[model samples]
Every structure is written in C-alpha cells, then in structure tokens.
Target: MAAATAETPTDRMPILAAVCLAAVVLPLGFAGGAVATPAIGADLGGSPTAMGWITNAFMLTFGSSLMAAGALADQFGRKRLFMTGIAAFAALSLALSLAPTILVVDILRAGQGFAAAAALAGGTSALAQEFEGYARTRAFSLLGATFGVGLAFGPLLAGFLIASLGWRAIFLSGTIIGAIALLLAGKRMRESRDPHAVGLDWPGALAFTAMLTLFTYGVIEAPEVGWSHPIVAASLLGAAATLAVFIAVETRSARPMLDLTLFRYPLFIGVQVLPVATCYCYVVLLVLLPLRFIGVGGLSEIDAGLLLVALSAPMLVVPLIASQLVRWFSAGALSGAGLLLAAVGLFWLAHVDPAASGMAVILPMLLIGAGTGVPWGLMDGLSISVVPKERAGMATGIFSTTRVAGEGVALAIVNAILASLAEARLSTFVPQGGAEIRAAAQRLAMGDVHGAAAILPALPAAEIHNSYAVAFQHLSIVLVGITVVSALIVFALLRGDRASSPRAKSPDDTGFDSIKTGSAMS
Candidate 1:
C-alpha cells in the first residue's frame, strides 16, 4: 500500500532498513537449497536429474527477469515493484513449502526467482535515489554486509534447520522474513518514477529469457538424457536462434533491455565478466563441497556446514580492509590474483582422498576463502566504475544478471561433467549388464551414492566410489585450468589498468567510491 505521498526525513531509516532486509534473499536464493537438495528429493519423490531443476529454474528466471524488472521499475515506481516482489516471493515460498510434488515446487520456485528479480532491482535503485554522498556509502556498505552475512552463514542455518526442523522449514522462514521486509517498505517507502519513461521492451525481454532458458536446459539435461538426444539438440538450436533474435530486437529498440554498446569497452567487459566468473566458481564449490563432505568424507550435515566457515566466513571480514589492499595493488591485479589463488585451492582439492581428515579439507578451504575475498572491494568498485552514471541502473542490472546466470551455467556445466564422466567410469566397473547396470550408473553419476550402492554389489559399490573420486578430480582439474586461464587473460587485458577506485558524484562518472570509503562485499 502507498504510505508516504512525498519524501520525508522519516523515510530514510525505513528505506535503509528495507534495503538491508531485502538482501537476505540473495544468499537464500544462492545457497539455501544446496544443503537440502537430497533431503528434498527423498521427501518429494523426485529423480536426482529432476532435482537439478530446482536450482536451474530459479537461476534462469532470476537472471533473465532482472533487467526487465529494472526497466519497469523506472517506468512505474521502485517502491511498488519492491513491495510487490517481496510479497509474491513470500507467497511462493509458502506455497513451495506445502507442495506435494516436485513438479509444483519447480514451477513455483521459478516464480520465486522472477519475483526476486523485481525485489533486487527495485531495492537497489531505490537506495541510489534515496541516499546521497556519505550516507549513501554507509547504506550500500550495510546492504553488502547483510548480503555477506547471509552467504557466510546460510548453509549453517540450512544445516541446523534440516537436522532439527526439516527441509520445508527454510521456505517457511523465507516467507516470514519476506513478509517482515514487505511491512517495512510498505509503511515508509516514498515511491518515485521517471516521467520520461516509455513502454517496456517486451520482445527483447522474451527473447533474452528464451535464450538463457533453452541454453541452460540443454546443458543441464544433456548428460542424463544423452548428448545427441533430439530434445537436447533442439533446445541448443533454439537457444542460438533466440540469442540472434534477441540481438536483432535490441539493435532496433529505442529502449533496449541490454545495451550491446557496453561491449565496446574491454575494461567494462572484464569488469562485468569478473563477477560472473568468480560467482561461477564460488557457487559451484558452495554446493559441491558440502555434498563431497557428506558423500565422500562421510560427514554429517552439521559437520559439513561447519567446515564451510573456512570458505565463507572470510567473505565477511576481508571486505572491510580490501580497499587498503587495493590501494597497494590495482583492482585488476587483485582480481586476477584472487582467481589464481582460487585455482590453487582447487588443485589442492583434487588431491584430497575420500578418507582425508577435517584439517585436510579446512586448509584448502581457507585458501579458497581468502582468494575469493580479496577482490570483493575492488570488484564492487570496478563493476560500478566501467559504466557511465546515466547507466547506473543498467550496470546494476547487468552485474546481477551475469552473476546469477553465470552461477546457473556453471552449475549445469559441473553437473554435466560429473554425470557424464562418472557414467563412463561406472560402465568400466560393471561392463556386462542390461537396464539394471545402466540405471545404477545413472544413479552413481548423479551422486546418489547410497542408491547406487543399494543396487550394486559391495565390490562394485567400492568401484563406483573410486570412479566418482576420479571423475571429481578430473572436474576439479578442469576448474583449475579455467580459472588459471581466465586470470591470465584478464591480467593481460588489464596490463596498465590502475588500482584506483573511481567515485561518482555527477552523471558522467560511475564507481563505488563508497565501497572504497566503506566496507566491501561482492
């Protein structure tokens, strides 16, 4: 409901509070279901392959819907979109918690992602409009801090909730938190909209969404469904076609959803791609590592969650001092260096035996954390810097879309690699069989360790474990190679790029000087 007819001094604190509270959704969307996926499948009777959709659906919709939401927020009002998004997301979460089948959850979860797009775009744009100078810096810093806190402890919260309450409890919690945020915004937010805004670019939005959805679907489904399956091929072809149409649509539109001209700046491209690449690595590990601890290391959920403190806790502390580090080294150098360090951590992960102790995992985890953490302030500054002030909204949209979509794509790639490689290895272990062996192999590739064991003999189960390890190590090596290569490429591209964080006061310049003067979190 409309609360304030005009901006008032009282609106500032409530607006700030709403922005921070809304940040809770970020980590919940990113890391919440990871620790609870297996439990979700067990409770809901979904196949392992189908369960992958839970994350994919959310990611696809969230990424694809974000830019469009940003555009609409300008045309309508930020507060309106923000409150609507929070309300819809809360309702969806409650519905998700009560769903009797996986089909309903997947569909509703995707809806939640779309709802989240509105919240993210509106909440951030509202802050930029409402606050200025020193206060704006503090507000955004607090917002980023809340986001980091969510990422740092989300898994632990999931662990305890899954162990003590149930998988469904998290959804209920999401609903409650969202409702609280909605109340805060609805009571005090001063709605504002641009008078020069025109109608939305619906065709561009549709084409872009189709492109991402088709491509992600192809990748995620290819391993289980077979690489050359007609549907997979069709999906991939459809993705390409949709991408071409999207470009064509954007080229002609007066108000395009994406400004392809942004690609002109190599530095801008690097800044945008940096978050995508880093988030790709971070989300993959956050999901896969806990599964590794459970399936391979035989740790309980709580224990596995506790181990992630080494990986995530640094995200909280490092950002506070990261700007100082950036002063000594350029943001470009720090970003590349951080990625290389992450690659080293992955290399160490490849060496971990299934029977390795807690300390063995902890050390490499700590390395990964510091590696990922050092670039936060610089990244925040850099992403904002490369774009003009007039396009601040567009920059935020691009930054968020790439980051979310990258995580989704990375997940599909990881799952495909694991499933395909593991399946190949399993066939070698159990060479002579019909449907039973093939079915068991499918289960193994999906990391359903116990289910695969239940189907095969004890000796074959051990072989399946060994095969899983080898396949996982191979995937880790691939990740290392990708990270190392990306770091080198970026380093070369930014050869003379300075370490300074750009500040924005006028409409011509844009950067997170606030992040530099304040705390940083990516």
Candidate 2:
C-alpha cells in the first residue's frame, strides 16, 4: 500500500506533462486573435465582427463544454479521454490553418474549443485523483502558475509569429504543440478509470451545450443587433428554456452531468460565484487597457504588450505569496480585498486622458493585477475542497464554466457600452461626413493614434484629445462599478471562517483514502 501510494504520482507525471502542454494551446489559440485580427481580416475580407466571432466562438464552446467533458472524464478513463481530446484538437488546429473561408475557420475554432474543454476537464480531475494532501495542493498551484504564464506569453509569441510568418503559422504552431502532447501522453500516461462510475448522461450534456450556445450567441450578437431583435430575444428565451430543461433532467436522471445537490453547500456556491465576478472584471479591464494604450495613447502593439507586463507580472508572484497569505486571511477576505482594489484601480483609470503617460495608465493595471492576484489559488482550493473526490471533475467543470462564461458576458457588456458611448461621442464631435471626420472615427474605433494625429491637421488637436478622453472616462466609470459590485458580492457570499484553518480535511478525503488502499487504483 505504501509503495503503491508513493508510485501514484510517478505514474501521473506523464499525463500531467501532457496536460501542461495542452493547456498552453488554449491561451495561445485565444490570444492569437489579438495580434492576428488585422491580418486575418485583410486576408479573409472579413470585418471586425468576423474577428469577434473568431474568439467568441472559441470561448463559447470552451465554456459550454466544460461541465459535459468533466462528467465524461468521470465516466471514462481520464488518460484515454484526455488523449482523445488532444488528438481532436490537433486535427482541428490543422483544419483551421488550412481552412478556405472565415466561416470554415469559425467552425474549426468551435471544434478546438470542445477539444480544449475535454483536455482541461480530464487533466485537472486526473491530477487531483493522482496526488494526495500537500502534493495535490502543490500540483494545483503549479497548474495556476502555468495558466498565468501561458496567458502572459501567448500574445507576445503571437505577435512575433504573426510578424515573422503569416497568421497561419499560429495554427501551425498549435499543431506541433498538440502533436507533441499527444505522443507524450500516449507513451507516458496511465489510465485512471472508475469501475463504479455512472454511465454517460448524454441527454444532460446535449441540453447544457444547447443552452450555452444560445446564451453565448445571444450575448455576442446583442452588441450588433439590438437586444430586442427577434433573433436575440428568441436565443435568450431558448437559453433559459434549455437551462430549465437541463435542471429538470439532472434531477430525474440516475447520474446527472452536474449534480445540482453539490451547490447546496454555501462555500461551494460562494467560491464559484466569486470567480465569476472576478473573471468578468478581469477580462473587461484587460481588453480595455490594451485598446486604451494603442488607441488614445498611440503606443505600438509591442509597446502595449510590454506595458501590459506590469499587470501580468504580479499574477506570477502573488500566487506564491498567496499560498502563505491564505494561512493568515480567509479566502473570502482576500477575494473581497482584491475586488475592492480592482474597482479603485478602474475608477482611477477613468480619469486618465490622451495626454496621460504610459506609466500613469499602467499604474491602475498594476493595482488591478495585484488585487486580482490574491484570490487565484484560494478560489480553486475552496471549490474542490467541498466536493467529494468522485465529483472533483464535475466541480472543476462548473468552476471553469462559470469563470469563462463571466468573461464572455463581461466582454459583451463592455463592448456594448463602449461602442455606444464611442458612437455617441463621435457623432457629437464629427457631425459631417467628410474625409477627415471619417478618418478620425476609424482611428478612434481601432484605437490608433496615427489616425487621430492625422485628423489634427484639419481639426483642433485639443478637440481630438478631449473627445478620446471623454469616451475613455465613460468606460472607466463602468469598469469601476463592476469592480465595486464584485467586491460586495464576495463579501456577502464568502464566509469569514472558511479559510481560517489549513488543517481541515476536504470532503473527498474518504474517497481519496479508499483509492490509496488499493494497489491497482494508483
């Protein structure tokens, strides 16, 4: 038994390595759009709306499939499911690279999203099952660290690759990474199958997927089409109905895709909600900051990327300190503090103008980063801590789903708000349809400084600067409100005592102990 317990982690190393490699692909694939959007549009003859779909499609599928894949991982063998996912993803990456049309690319992007969901759901669960106590905590910490690193490096790598090779090279790189991950997984990964696990809940999976697809589609399109549009209304109604059906089915099914009963625990529910709000604020700010720098401040892509480093750097370092801080502060406390800081940062950002230095703009990002950093590990730990080991996959699935869904919703909201404000401001500033006004409007939309500069030859420089500043101020107010609301939610939902003790055994200890008892289990 002792030998078997000791060997479990060794057997798991290969799969973990494969997971890490597969994980990088997600951030890379998602971030590639930021750098390659202009190039992709030029090549495909698509507009910014098409570009939005490119990323939105990926996120929607990724977020929607998580719970379904988690349940699948629980039903199937983790290693087998994980490898299968990577294989599918690799094939789709190649397809995306070779796609003849933007529509085809969108379809392939959706496929990639599904594959990623499988990999993430199966890999995270397998890691939890394989490791014990301190090792498990360390493994999870490393996972968070890797995720942050991937996000930080993805855009930079995409910029370099897109500059050197065509945007196709981004997909090509994914193919290589996916292939390597598959090979390593096939060779080194060990199967983790649960003989007594329930059968696949196909009905539940389908319903959940449909619901998310409708909701995501509705949200994404709402910005272009009015929310009251018949299609948008129908989509929203369909989403609600599908979700209702999903719940009803889960309640009646022998084995549900998501065990709704788990949410009864306050801690479990709180942890999930906390991340949703935090993630919404985080992604919105991330999206807005880069646009602000490039559009109004007139920084280059490379320069904006570097300035953004100040925001991401804290994420890398804060988690390490967070591990220790969790010993002193409750997860709720830390999370609430983080949200407050983020809100304050956004409020400060609202005051920045076209004349503000890069350093000044970056200050708010730094504050937001530091505030957001403290809750990273604590939230994950809290979510899974309350779930039984058998349900770890499900818990992780829900956790991931909520986080990504929040991100999508947040981006949509921010985009709608900013678009409306910018349009209104633009109309006020440039009433006529002249070349100079058209040029200024376009520059403001792209966040390009050169276009703004060109307009100065015809229009007053101060007026151009004031218009941009006014638009940004409105954006800041919304962001600040989001942050503050998130903070309040955290305070209300999270318990003060939940993170007080480090010695508390998670709910899954019994299942984990049982697994430790059997030699074949590891």
In model 2, where do residues sit more than 4 Å from their true spots?
1-12, 291-298, 354-357, 427-469, 496-522
lDDT of 2 by residue, 369-401 (tens): 777777765566555656666677777888888
Model 2, position 95, has a per-residue lDDT of 84
Which number leads on TM-score? 1
Whole-model Cα lDDT of every candidate shown, in order:
0.73, 0.69
Instruction: State, as a TM-score between 0 and 1, how close model 2 is to the true structure.
Output: 0.85
Worst 10 residues of 2 by lDDT: 511-520
Candidate with best lDDT:
1
Error of 2 at 112 (Å): 1.0
Runs with alpha carbons beyond 4 Å of true place in candidate 1: 1-13, 133-138, 355-357, 388-390, 432-442, 493-522
Q: After superposition, how far is residue 125 of candidate 2 from its true place, in Å?
A: 0.7
